[model samples]
Target: MAKGYWITFYRSISDPGALAAYAKLAGPAITANGGRFLARGTAAKAYEQGIAQRATVTEFDSLEQAIAAHESAAYQEALKALGSACERDVRIVEGLG
Candidate 1:
């Protein structure tokens, strides 16, 4: 099966502390569910209208695993910690090959 990826874009961040807390929980949660970070942080440049202030990409062994990581209790805790501290978009996609 094709690999899966989680792509997240942060449009704005109103609370750094909340984001930090979310990251702390989310990182371990993702890893435990077979997800690995590929890229994270602000973009070097924006050449498109949809680009946000920050972007994150995580790879997973399969689409199911990617979705599972997002739904897992640990990640849910992270989301609760975040609690609208930022505006962001997240997408899960299957890799090309």
Candidate 2:
């Protein structure tokens, strides 16, 4: 089966403390749902029209699991904590096995 990837690009983070709080809850929630964070932080370099920003790439056993991790009640709590602290784009894509 193809692996699932959850990618997030943070355009801006207005409140670092809120993000920190969300991470505390989100990490465990994601792990429980079979997520492995491969890379997370500001981009080292940007190319083309891309602008350097904070990003995260996570691998999941499957697409369903990735979706579940994002929607789970635990993750929902994390989102609540995050509130409107940042602007980000999140994507879930399938990759070759």
Candidate 3:
């Protein structure tokens, strides 16, 4: 089954340079693991009040593939560089059967 990963980030972005650096590092890792970016930085027009500054959704061939991607060494390095610069909410879900 396909797997989906959703990530929401609320970041003030103290450093755009750092964000770009991290993106460069992580983007390739995901692609290498057979992941595809579905939506990124998509604005949500309707909500009660609080909302994430950015929302991203990605799909992988399988749940194991998704998990493996996140657990990969390259991604972990990129995630580490991200530090506490942003608050992130991430979830991995199996697609409908």
The local distance difference test score of model 2 is 0.94
Candidate 1 steric clashes: 0
Per-residue error for 89 in candidate 2, Å, reads: 0.2
After superposition, which runs of candidate 2 have C-alpha atoms over 4 Å from their true positions?
none
> What C-alpha lDDT values do all the predictions have?
0.93, 0.94, 0.75
Give lDDT: candidate 1, residue 51. 66
Q: Compared with the true structure, what per-residue lDDT tens digits does model 2 show for residues 13-64?
A: 9999999999999999999999999999999998896669899999998998
TM-score-superior candidate, 2 or 3: 2
Best by lDDT: 2
> How do the predictions measure up, each by TM-score?
0.95, 0.95, 0.82
- By lDDT, highest first, what's the ranking? 2, 1, 3
Task: Give model 2's TM-score versus the native structure.
Answer: 0.95
Worst 10 residues of 2 by lDDT: 46-55
Residue 4 displacement (Å), model 1: 0.5
Could you tell me which residue pairs clash in candidate 3? none
| Predicted candidate 1 versus true structure: per-residue lDDT over 1-97, tens digit per residue | 9999999999899999999999999999999999999999998888867664889999999998999999999999999999989999899999987
